[model samples]
Target: MKSNLVCRNRETVRINEYIHMPKQLSPAQVEQFWNDGFLFPVDAFDGVQAKKYRNLLEEAERDHPGEIHAEHRNNAHYILKFLDEIAHHPVILDVMEDLLGPDVLLTGTVLFIKEPQTPAFVSWHQDSTYTGIEPKEGITVWVALSEASSESGCMQMIPESHHQGILEHHDRFGENNILTRGQTIEGIEKERAVDVTLKPGQISLHHVRTVHSSTPNRSDDRRIGLALQSFIAASVKQTLGEDYALSVRGQDPFQHFLRARRPQSDYEPEGIAFREAANQRLSDILYHGSELKRDY
Candidate 1:
């Protein structure tokens, strides 16, 4: 499993030979991700560590009234350094690198939080549909900050649906659907879906074309999950618009994206401006040529 990767300025280096790569995801789990279109319960952080992140998010929500709402949550990693740290966490990078090779780029991250007995829920859809990344060269790592169970609205995926490629999706704009456009697919058998349950500090990885959604939270506690999108740097290109990606591991010789910088502080004026501009561009790409522009 040794290979040479090219970095910026046409430089080449051996990934495994020079770097201390951790074996996070076992071969069985990797195979499951490919075969079942998703793998869950990958231990990422401990319960104590998870609580620290949850506290930060709660503090942010309390500090800024509506700033953490649906429209602003899409790219929260770029706006806050703490979120960015989690996205670039060593454990997460190791798993992503194992699947996407050494050259990995973080495209975007969105925080989906469901309140107790709330109507908020995600509709069934594929991430590749609106992502605009061709050839389905991406994986989404969903990290749970709190316990995620069927009762708390954990994500559910249809096994082997990713092999069918991208399916037809129609925008319904459901009132309580958490998805940006309320996009959904038809003819899906709900009974075939598997709940991707995870304890606090665990995560689930799914392919870009996987058909997935979440139910409304029925428990009293809040359900917090961060959806991180990772792509191989070599596969990145200016498909819909300028691709804004942060290289988390190895090097990106392709230069296909606008390299994002680390934030100095959470919600700084300059960082907020940059995050807003980048998010606007992404929304235009994901919601382009469509009448329905649901806030992400």
Candidate 2:
């Protein structure tokens, strides 16, 4: 279908207050997201813009090679500062509203770089465990800047896994599921794993509680993705003095940021509240962990 959203020379689109999707999501797709807690192939960024962002990331890596983690040699650099330009992007806001409703807050931003030949594997787990958010209804939009496929270590998810509620998790490098409060859940069928492959610019939106993971890059091309997680304000509750903490750019270290959504029908309240809550929560949890300390 032709997009009414016009692009400026294929690199960027001029998004104003009137942003809307050329095609509204079908009722089935909406139900799928609600029931399964994930959505795939939602247009957030286009090819040209993805290329531009990729170049920016490459430059960041080149200038700051030291910033690249040793264990993640295949992994490079990332940043997540506020960008009014992105906030106004039509496709982004459109999908944000569709999934999160009108009241969506920006919780956290991450730029994941998997260099070629990197053997780092992200174990299966739920994202809400790390965010420390209550309700755990947040949405994480993963935007692929390059062609991501199973051969190149794309993401994998368990179908309808979120329906199982929070599962038991272990720390990637530690003994207990540092963020899971030492709790564990049984009954995950490993045979149901599904790999996600996508072309450059394609995006996937999943719930914070969804069981997901990614393999190391075995492909020659680098695998890069920008992850933006959003939530509704009402779903976020403060959790301070907890064993686990959520770290952000400028805030003191604290444990967990809850993901929440405004009542589904109240769009305006949801959007405004989410925006404010995310800013505070992200600023608090953005950079908790230090640089990578392993050799993949």
Candidate 3:
């Protein structure tokens, strides 16, 4: 057992390699996730593959500036082949199938990156606050393409907060906030927060209603994470307007929303239309019931 595939970007990544990393959660681990609302450090791939994907992402940023910029960051897989491949990754989906059952649908992805020494941060919020899905069984599988350490402002979760069942949230639309609506849940116990530090190719999965946020990056390297969000059970239906998702796994008998296809290339017609419809509906859903309307 010499090949641990340590992520070179962080000293702790190598230190953590000796520990057992399972592609799928154990029964006991599964119980803990339900009880705690979040689980982390699930092995999805090796650091070598992670580095390759990182390079691909940076290359895209350099070559095609606006393609993955702004709101495009939300559904990046529509334009980038690597992101699409990552979305449909078998190892990651195996873990998803374990938690979400055989019939899984992927709504979209969000690429959150914190530049070194930047004040950019996500406010405390539950994803269920915006995503208008019923039954609330959806999960967000956040995959780290780079080192996600405490110094890098890794996500911090309020354990078992999903049990609180979508607490009240207010919108700030703050200057440095990275969230679409700058949505925030007030009054969290900081003493109870758990830092979800991860290394390249590792992933953290959390319930849709889990309360979470991140601090600003203090480290020299940019912290990059691809959130494969809204992995929902086939039985769940959209409570808001029309939405779209790709059936990444088994059959979807309910058919709550329109089925989206993987883009053949960057900015193709079908993909563009799919993204426009889904994103527009998402905006309305997230901005629903807000008294203060602000440009996001």
Candidate 4:
């Protein structure tokens, strides 16, 4: 558990071998996240590994055709081993712990895949608008399974928007919008937004309150990304009723949300059923009191 580092530019600063120091987020990067609301292109996985991960999604689609639809894309980690592994990945978790502190919970995971020349788009809206998690202490790590270029509809966000707190959003449910309600924030200056472009295996971490959206894919290939939602376990409250959460690190003493069991195999019957039930619970929290059937 102990390691030593040798500095080339100066005398080596010997960090205590027993002390745990996180190298994921530099102080500047942490500040940038708080001030700008997001960070992009963090190296999380190698290209070869990323391709393998992407293959898992393709394989799932082949095995369970028509099941990865937007409404049903939530909680994929519960039924897929590849996704579950990424959900608990150390690199992602360490950065999350750096920002959210210990006691991290992998709350949800979903695929946002846009086929080539499709009308799919994500409306500009803050994730908190639907998450309903109180204290608002969480982040969404969008991991690119393929190149997330501007032409491929990479996510775009307004800087420092998180500091404004949750903004008002209205349900549009547009034909091409992938959001549950087609929710969007009004009057955003397109010129002020920054594209969160990423190559395969990289990631963009955005705060829950960050105003973000994506355009329709215009490329010749599919644009695939995984949104991994995590939060400080102790910060989760009962405001949205009992829910399911996976403890990826540290201890969960409060048990604010129901603990999820890892799947024994990909899409195991029991795991799928459990994920379905849990997704329904989540939908209730996100779209509470609405007549719309629980989806997403």
Q: Model 2 over residues 83-159: C-alpha lDDT tens digits?
A: 22343356765665555544445554455667788775566777776455555666777778898889788888887
lDDT per residue for candidate 4 within 55-147, as digits (tens), equals: 888988887865566567988888888888988888998888766667788788888999998989998999877777876657899999999
RMSD of each: 5.1, 12.4, 8.9, 7.1
Clashes per candidate, residues 3 or more apart or on different chains: 0, 25, 0, 0
Per-residue lDDT over 135-158 for candidate 1, one digit per residue giving the tens place of the 0 to 100 score: 565789999999899999999999
Error of 1 at 62 (Å): 0.5
The global C-alpha lDDT for each of the candidates, from Candidate 1 onward, is 0.81, 0.54, 0.81, 0.80
Clashing pairs in 4: none
Candidate 1: TM-score? 0.91
User: Over all chains combined, what TM-score does candidate 2 have?
Assistant: 0.65
lDDT of 3: 0.81
Ordered by TM-score, highest first, the candidates read 1, 4, 3, 2
Model 3 residue 128 CA deviation in Å = 0.6
Instruction: Give stretches of model 2 more than 4 Å off.
Output: 1-24, 65-88, 174-187, 233-235, 241-296
